[model samples]
Target: MGKITKYLNQLIVGNVFDTPEILEAYSTDRSVLKIKPKFVAFPESTEDIRKLMRFFNQIAAKEIPVSVTARGTGLDEGGADLSSGGLVISTEKLNRMLEIDPRERLVRVQAGITLRELNTALSVSGLTIPIGGHNNDTIGGLISNTPVDDSAGKYGGIESFVERVEVILANGECLQTSRLKKYNIAKKATEKSLEGDIYRKISKLLKTNAELVSEMSKNPTHDYSGYPAIVKLQYKDTLDLMPLFFGAQGTLGVISEVILKAVPLSKRPSRVVATFKELDAALEFAHKVKSLRPRKINFYDLKIIQEARESGKNLDGVIRKLEDGFVVLVSFDGRINSCVKKVANIQKEFPRNTKFIFETPENRLILNEFENALAAYLNSAKSSERVPILTDFYLPARNVSGFLKDLKVLEQKLDLDLALFGSYATSIYSLRPKFNLEDKDFNKKAATFLRAGAYIIDRQDGKLAGGTPEGRLKAVVTNTNMKDAEQILYSEVKRIFDQNNILNPDVKLGANSKFTLTHFRSTSLPKIML
Candidate 1:
């Protein structure tokens, strides 16, 4: 091992692994990228991370190409947190709830704690973070990924809940967003203080580029691809730097701790599935149901339900009851009486031809299973040689039907099998395509298909990759679509935070970055299809 690796082993109290087995295990995430890291360090505390950052700085000064990336549960769709040959800082050991202020309705936690664990602890106070169905995801990962939940129309995502965060800069110095709140006109401006310097610089940048920021804000997408539009910085009267880290994908700095706003748990929750015989009709009904203020509104294509049935899981009772068409699921949460009243209101407003399947408390568990089974069934439907390339994007409610039609046309033109599912409330949809990665010709065609799909979304004035942070795949597309002003602003912000480009290098900023299909783990498998 080199000096840096040896020093990291001595500094971190947890564990540092360099073995082939461990490296191989950390190589791939949910995406198809496979780049084995040179060293994997499990950090147990913020102090360890400080030391690691300092080491990175030292190596970077010596003209070494060393970089660092922090990972949570590795549940990301793409390789946002994955590194090729750099230091991988695994924050799993730092899992701890530092403070829970029930009165303030906020919780301060070590970034590595899982969502499930955090909610379990908060249950005592009858409060919980409102992120949906990602119990296995880590808090840090969720913050970085910025995933939109089923209830995004109601509660929004991590961006809405995050109060503040403590991040370690590229220079090994710690910076807290909470410090920005402490800044006042009465205090003398000190160039010596890092926080003060950053605040002044960012404030000036936003003030000078007010017009550009305003223009970019008009067409905001749920995409966490690059630095968020600077318009978010200008709050009511002052600037808030917390939103900058929401969907940053850890490119700015390592998030050490976060303070999230906690909400009271719902007293009673209810869900109903409304089936429609036509896509256009289901979409129209979904827009009307939005008026009822449901906690979540989700839509699934008929193929998803068909796949579930083919698995022989005895979904006949559920499928037979519904019409052969698109399915929309709406959920409401509050008092039992209020939830019931809301359901009644939805029924009255819904189209008369639509079939409603109200799930009672006794059968609610079954409904949950049915909803979860769709994703599972789609995964099993893929052929052995075919790899899943799932892409998510957002559009306005009025454009969803047109976008769906475009997707159908694209499928026919490319001769590929595809499935769509996601949050109807937010109009954020995911396109899952099965590609034979082993065939070079097929891979080339798949790339063309993605580029074309991106073009379609752009024409619709929609944003690409809404569900997760921009990884290699979406980064290329986002970069191509970014205006000159936006690109320059994004690059400037990246340079300010990570001057040396040691943190998640080449992600969301670098000019030479390219999205390629050669780095996947499946490349090592035999050419034969399973």
Candidate 2:
């Protein structure tokens, strides 16, 4: 029997696509890398997924590997690349709100549904999921791999809302895991790590998975393509599925459905804007507001804030003052009285250094003025002698000041315009440093900037735990010890989950500090090569 035909026949409730246009569309995400998949399928339901898993198991039984991945908006560091070319199962067709248990304050949804769609449905009921700050992601995808964003500080994280998940394992076994399963796995991982032929086989399979992920995309953002191999099986009543999937980045299994905690819509949301004379002053204000815990804290530099000014919108003189450095804006949501009180308390506590500007009707009109200013800057730069290269770095909350200092020092060395912004949502800082360089010289300057920033971070003795791929890559390549640790951890994890080696055949495991694909040549060998 033809193996491809047999596998194709087994699929139900999903469309199998293998066309040049479709392949090209699936090849690259938001990032830079491009790859081709042999087949892409979209299932209509969880049962369809189970059938796909069974097919994967059948292939594994014959020592054939299968590659799988789901697609969303591709906001990640290009983590959506299909691993190995055997099969790519797209959950996009599984979009459905299976259940919404209002009394339990939880809702169950198929993995294919987008966050925007889910929120629109919940808007009618006046309930919302406690997801990360960005509302553009998917629930099932988030549960498969936990995502961290601005809401991390106040509402816990994407993991906080997840109550449970339904998954189809690699071997075609249907598994349902609760939130507590992660804590147990974390504890188990702390003990002697598991080792065996099964582990060996899984490890081999993951090598293929890693290869495919690397081949999938070359974007430099926060995507951790393959990670969190352990599938959490149990959760505490208070614990939710949020922890299991939020940052897992889709390694263990494809999440078919997610049970999420739901919250009521806000009655009122008040805008509170603050401006600082310097980056440090703005960061200090962010720290203070952390206690007040507003719904969102957005920091913008004068360079970007110009977007607000050039819109021909009149600002309350605060726009003129923002030229001093940066602005920190916070939005308070909840009861109007309580929000007003909290704003008052915050203003009282940091009276001298911070300036609070109420977002009145006129001010509201220019809320996104900064984006316009940035567009103008970019427009002007595009017409200049050299194209501006944009690179970003993330630092932990406490190291924000230190990271800024390092950037300032680097600014003295490079002839570039550096704009720094702080995040009140997370303990991170974003930097946009622009310089004029020829196309041939861009990579060298980019590498130089990355190396310098990484060196400064290493010298400061700060450990980099999380950030976008670009930021994490800079940290890893710059520091030898961290690189070593990363390589070891990556290899160990890859070995445990993927067993077939078919996942993404073109990529390799433990090869790069960041998720960039490197070429490997294969030699013909006997059937019993293993």
Candidate 3:
């Protein structure tokens, strides 16, 4: 047998599934892209990863295209397409906590460990990872994407908590990268003209400094495109590997293990719910909180508030309208004693009319129930039919109010149903009325709205927000008019980390690439060719 076949069979303990069902399952992410892998391999341990890397190295010797793709919970940016054809290295089986150091306030876990699992494990030790979003994300995936959510203002993000990382390179070399040793490796990598290694070192430096910039620009959430800018910010002049992988999105290498910093478990947890009359009013309040730089801040629109109320989730009368067609919620969480004082301070900035709902333990239970029911309710509602698309964009935090005004104007111009919501400092998402009908008129209208939105965002120096582009619509929406050199930043990074273009080769960012199957199939990639 060929070396690839023999190595995979002999060294990996995980399952290898080549069935059509498995391929279909692995073909798409939450985002658009649709190429399928020739095979899927599930590796259970670092040893299994070592075996797979050896196999990949052997395959690389032949110079055939290959890439590694993985999902913590299958959350992707679009059309669920896997535009690259290669082996899908599934990390699901490699879920184990190697160490938890309470004294150092760090934990080491295998790539497949989900946030929920890690948090639960940490709970036993009376500690917790400070940053997480939506609960289901994998530790590896979060590190790869480097998301900073509610706690970003204070604790920073997944990237900040990352003390060290173990990764397998494109050629199957296992390397352990940390802050202290980053410069040495980076210096050598740079001297050797190794683009991938150099980028990794630079990224680590960037991550170190991202917290400061991120705090100031907190109003509209930052982008997590080619890689987290934090990597460059923290280690821009250093050897930090952070830049190489922060936004590699699993292209450069597989993160086998990570050591992350954690916060002590809150002995007394507290929650504060603040209500606003108008969306603008809530936004104004968010700006102040951003100035104070609180630990966590989340905003909920009227639609979500209504869902919470109607479902009889513990949020009874939690959200009442101050004006027509507007609702807002601000939730604050922290340690009990200090949290009360912080909430008091936050309340002073708001108008006397603003309502406050202090969450008891019972209220917390209700909030969970309400949030859990929200996804289903939104999915089933006919109102969603009116909004066919949701688009997100972020500018500097200070520019958010002006941006929202422009958005409202677009809503009026398009005569489309629209709702906007997001974290005050980090991001804002605009939801267009769902169009359930399959008629050409609906598609055309949706397209028009999307084009208009994209145009406005482009004019404001915004690119697509949230996830990767999946379809033609996403391609157009995210396509930037940036000059070739600027665009190459993304493409060059992609080429370096995803050298063979093996990992999700179809998802091109910052460039003028179309999101489509035909685009992926084409030999020569063009800016707009689909």
Candidate 4:
């Protein structure tokens, strides 16, 4: 590393830190895993990244075990940003909004820009990225994980919002990817560089398994286990390779910049904060909202509300009575008349006695502030940590009641006191059980809970990697649970762009239970952003 460090000092514009303190600091992400990187590089520009990648590619060519993981904000609950005994490439310094075309409704920005900052800038243009409900995350991180968007019900997955992506390939070649006609793909395949090789091999493989590829192209319930955008690799005569690269979790390529298709901000927004005396009614309304594909719909079950109350958190506006029922907050954004009519139509489907409020500043401000309740649940007076296992999974709309009952039974069996809540619009649920980390058998219990809960989700037509992307922590769950053919296809895709597996190994493709158990941290030491 001494020789490598010296060479890197002159390689690029950004800082290179291999100090013990820096290595220890960048070791972990939001996930409970700590892997001290041999070197952490903060590349300042696209050229810097390409130089670093080229240098690493040369190192890997020597039969050395060198892997690289990209870091942006380090908000990953999954181990997508962790690399043991390798380099951690931080995109922090590259954070910038390059261009905004209000007329074209396109925003080009560095991938390291935080969602909050991007939205802040886009506010002037009345545009915003359609994915990510959280502000603390970076565009690069979101693009890699492709987590289920809170507003996915309205604007499909990230693919719909992403116009083009600038990716630095494993061998440091810069390739700008977008939808291309078959002839353009053919032209790309004819080139002799790494980019050309990727296009040739991926296009060939996708054509070979065209039917399976086509099946995976459907974005019904986006799977974070494998490539989520495997959907529509080719539509009609157009072929796009971004699907193979974007959500592969930096295992395939490093994203430098992203050109996003921004949507118009809602001028007139209407919200409904409804409390249900019965869970059935709330769930029914939630499904209706899901069908309507509104901008926002969040559901907090009775357990969450009760937990909030027990934690000494005031829910004066949100939950009036701490009883066993559901609290739903659904909002629509558009013209005032359209929002009103849509709200009225959904309301008509329910009984006339439904408790409802138009959700105003003067009225109870519950819908927008319930995140504090979730924080309360995690930081209850008790010392138990809210274990992240069983956090993100998709739930089908049909027979949700029976599936929920099974969840309750599972909760009781584990004695972990699970709380259910998440974006109802996406039908994604977060079930984090409270458990004391100091317990001797904490890891065992978490593993058991994760496996059993994932089984129940699959059995009930639900699936893992819905809300949370399957980083290293849940890789054991998502990878093992995948269909055999799907696994094979993902492997081939990994081989195409990342032939040497030099990019972010032991992640989506190379993940195993042994690595998960070995690397998972106990107290979750987070990386310090530069």
User: lDDT scores for all predictions?
Assistant: 0.73, 0.54, 0.57, 0.77
lDDT of 2 by residue, 1-530 (tens): 34573556565756677777877566644332344667777778778777776776676768766666655544443234444355667777777898887777789888778888898898888898655434556776565435456555677666667767776655555556543343444443354322223333433443455544343334232333323322221123222223323444454456788778889877555677776676667777777766777776767777666643554434455554545577777766755567656666767765476677776667665654532444444343332321212223345567666766776778889766666654557654444454443344644565566566656655654322233322123323523443343445445554444455333323323224334322111111111100
Which ten-residue region of model 2 has the weakest summed lDDT? 521-530
lDDT, residue 271, model 1: 78
TM-score of each: 0.92, 0.74, 0.78, 0.93
lDDT of 1 by residue, 164-269 (tens): 8889888788877753333561141355654556676777778788888888788675667778745687765667677788778788789999998999988566
lDDT of candidate 1?
Answer: 0.73
Candidate 4 residue 90 Cα shift, in angstroms, is 0.7
Best by TM-score: 4
- Location of the lowest summed lDDT over 10 successive residues in candidate 1: 521-530
**In model 3, what is the error at residue 190, expressed in angstroms?**
10
Select the stronger candidate by TM-score from 3 and 4.
4
Counted clashes in each candidate structure: 0, 34, 58, 3
**Alpha-carbon RMSD, candidate 3:** 6.8
TM-score of 3: 0.78
Each model's Cα RMSD? 3.3, 9.5, 6.8, 2.7
Better of 2 and 3 by lDDT: 3
